[model samples]
Target: ASHGTVHPDNEDWTCFEQSASLDIKSFFGFESTVEKIAMKQYTSNIKKGKEIIEYYLKQLEEEGITFVPRWTPPVACKSESSTSHTRRPVSPAINIPDSATKEGLNNKEILNTSSSPSEPTAGTPDDKLDADYIKRYLGDLTPMQESCLIRLRQWLQETHKGKIPKDEHILRFLRARDFNIDKAREILCQSLTWRKQHQVDYILDTWNPPQVLQDYYAGGWHHHDKDGRPLYVLRLGQMDTKGLVRALGEEALLRYVLSINEEGLRRCEENTKVFGRPISSWTCLVDLEGLNMRHLWRPGVKALLRIIEVVEANYPETLGRLLILRAPRVFPVLWTLVSPFIDDNTRKKFLIYAGNDYQGPGGLLDYIDKEIIPDFLGGECMCEVPEGGLVPKSLYRTAEELENEDIKLWTETIYQSASVFKGAPHEVLIQIVDASSVITWDFDVCKGDIVFNIFHSKRAPQPPKKDSLGAHSITSPGGNNVQLIDKVWQLGRDYSMVESPLICKEGESVQGSHVTRWPGFYILQWKFHSMPACATTNLPRVDDVLASLQVSSHKCKVMYYTEVIGSEDFRGSMTSLESSHSGFSQLSAATTSSSQSHSSSMISR
Candidate 1:
């Protein structure tokens, strides 16, 4: 056996045994015969070996084992057709790694050959191209992008709505977009110029003139030529001097004449007679009776007279009546100006028409009487005393007496003459008496009782001492006593008989008279039992009840005490009695409960 070639004697003839054991039936079967023929061809020359390998490869390709390769070529035999003609053998497949194997080669080659250069790239660009192609081919698109494009188109249409004209360029653009012509035209008409024209029309349609001012313009009182047209044609007549003189008076007429222009004066003079005098002079004589020459010849009136004199001097043939008739309105206007300068009495006389019973034109007399007189009187009239009014007579007399003095008395005796009176209430009179050092009284007709006491001597009396009655008494006329008393005990008793007490403790100094009959310690006892039962059980609180009782008692005491003191010399005595009386009253009052109700029957009448 040779290591380089086929072994002949070795028992391990695996290749020869495999070939020898092949069944003839298996060899004739489709795949096995081809394999057997391939083995015989491979054992011949190198070229034959390539041919056998190619033949097996072709058989394998037909059997669908396309991934397998034969590492040999197919054998080629020369043909007898031509000497230069040669057959080219089929090439064998080179050995490829398993990684290089390609199954389904026909489908792969078809895919590669069919693919174009224009095919899309990988990633986003491929996706975009696919989307675009689908849109172009299949008309598919995302709703969002479609909607955005629609909105943009709508906005463009609105923006250009009324701007484009119906011309070729615009029409071509519209035609390309398949837009409606009528809609385009309608939008175009909404251009700024068209809108502005409509706005102007709208404003004109609503315009209205002010009717009131138009009516005023038409009324003709404002007559004047405007723009060479007779716009307002009302004419005014010349003023009538006779009528104005009758209306405004002679002085006003004269002043008005003086104010007329030289042309007016000449016109007036031409209508007059040759006599040199103002037309107003004769008019004044006729209109006013007993017209005083002195009153008429004032400096202002004389200046006006000079104008008339000059006019008469210039035109010697001018007559008064002719001038008056021609310038009738001047005299009245002048009179109105001059009338205010006259003395009030003279003006009144002139306005009143002194000689005539007629009320004067324009009711001048009535106006003066009604309006002017009252105004003048208000300015000048003094306030006069009314009937039965008081007049002060003298400082020595009492106010009442002085007030009562007869007015005739001032006319009769110089010493008893009345001065201006100052009236006051009776209470005020009392206050005046109390304020003054010396008070005088006239008691000719006393309506009420005049209870009074004089001091024993002319000198001012000393304060009285407390007496045996526990009261303070002063000496009266004829040794009669007038007492000043604390009122608590005598509230319901005779007020005249009541007396004030002089209080003294046992063994204490007794400067004034004390009650000798009472033994032991006797204090000034002020027992106050309300005569009219307290009406204030309805009082809300203890303090209220106390207040009500105190107020009522104090008011009553003050009134009674004032009357008593006013009737006599009790001021000194009463002043001392007040403190002790108030203390005793308070003690007695506090002992009683405020809530205790007084019998209503006691307060009935």
Candidate 2:
């Protein structure tokens, strides 16, 4: 029996079963008709299964679903593999928008692909030609010029910030084709000509320093010092004087001078021959009297005494009264030497003899009696003694109270007479020195002679000379003698004495001869002898002295002692008085008195 299943559609199999008589017998022999029926049934089920699969596949195709089998044959296994080949599919072309196409065209590629006359390329001969052309034309131009052309090209770009015409690019390009640096610079300068004209006009219109007299004055021409410092010279008295008249008008000058003092106006009239001039009526007489009283007289008196001690050390023969000449010339020269020191007819008689050749002699006396005496002895006068002599302040309550009509007349008469004569009369000059017990000579101008000569008296100790070994040797002073500190100490002591009233009063008569003495001349003489050498040396420098008195930092007082014998000690006592007045709290009474005595002894020695 055949074991293979038969299909239900195989009609031939049924027929074959009936036709094969031998097969039926064989079939009935082991497995009868039932076994054959079973085989046929199995074959029919297989055929039905195949038909159902085919129907489902057809339905899926109609519904647009693809059916793929799980197992697939390799390419090598396919029959068409040796005869056919596979290839990738080509992509479709993209359709660009019209706006994008237009933009691309407008951009116009700067890199030229064609080997044409206009194209630029690295390998092209035209590139070589263009470079060669640039080398030939711009080789002579500086780096600055080359940079400027490059900047100019950048400025011509459409995106540039300036408002140059679009056609400027074409013009620049044409110029570059045949460039010349000098011509380019010339064109640039021409473009700025209008600007230069506007600048010139602006400068001229705004210029200053106008042409006028006042402008010249303000510009610092007339009254400037040599180094351009500002200077103003004020005229004090007799403004109608030539100097004043030239600077200010005659009327203004006269008015200014008269305003200083009514006495000045009167003096101008009396001494018209002396002060009055051809061009102007007035003269400039610096008010030196106040300056003398304040600076030179009071302080100078103290310095004069110190100077006398130093002078006496060398010139032992020089009398003590000789130092009195250092007193101021104006007051002393009048009272002590020139005119009589009496008030009544004595002064008038002297003036009458003195002014004989000039105007009425009696007129001189009248002028003195009225103007000169009142002015000198007035309350406005200020006086102080140096080293405590008979100070005017101590003699009377005030200068006004101290006024002696006789002394005033005497002083005025002498001043008026002296003023008439250019120099002091010979008789008067002699009396001044004689009273001070000093002999004087008029050397040089006779105006600068002080009563004592400190510089002449003291000689600086000699220094050692070199020995044979070429080393200098000095002699040391013995322990018994005082050791001097410095030359300044010596100089200080000398200068201080010269400033004392006694010395200055004496020195003034001898040196100036222009001054006469007052009644207390002997007191000043004694005071000079009493000032201590150490105290003199300890006094301040002249500059400080001037400054102190001017600022009132140093108060000056004059104490009087009647007895001439102890007057030197009295003057010595004034050193303490000055220290006290100066507000030196450290000063003790013992130290003060001791220092005063010590200072006086040093001067006496």
> Top model by TM-score, which number?
2
> What is the TM-score (0 to 1) of candidate 1?
0.11
Q: How do the residues 52-124 of candidate 1 rate in per-residue lDDT, one tens digit apiece? A: 5457656765786533221222554353221211111221111111111223121123112322336422222
Decoy 2 TM-score against native: 0.14
Error of 1 at 326 (Å): 23
Model 1: CA > 4 A from native: 1-286, 289-298, 320-605
Across 1-605, the per-residue lDDT of candidate 2 in tens digits comes to 21211212211111001101123345446665654575456445534543554466466657865523323246445442222111110011111222323233211121111233354223321212312322322223222233344334333343433332211222233243233334543443333342244332233234332222111111111121221112111211111121111222222322222222222222322332232221101221111121122221211232223333322221121110100111222222222222222222212222111112212332322222222211222413121211111122112223253254332333233221110011111111111212112221221111221222211113332322223111101111110111112234454453223223323222121222111111112111111122234344455667744643432221111111111112223223223221101111122223224422111100100
lDDT of each: 0.24, 0.24
lDDT of 2 at 213: 15
lDDT of 1 at 44: 42
- Using all chains and alpha carbons, the TM-scores for the candidates as numbered come to 0.11, 0.14
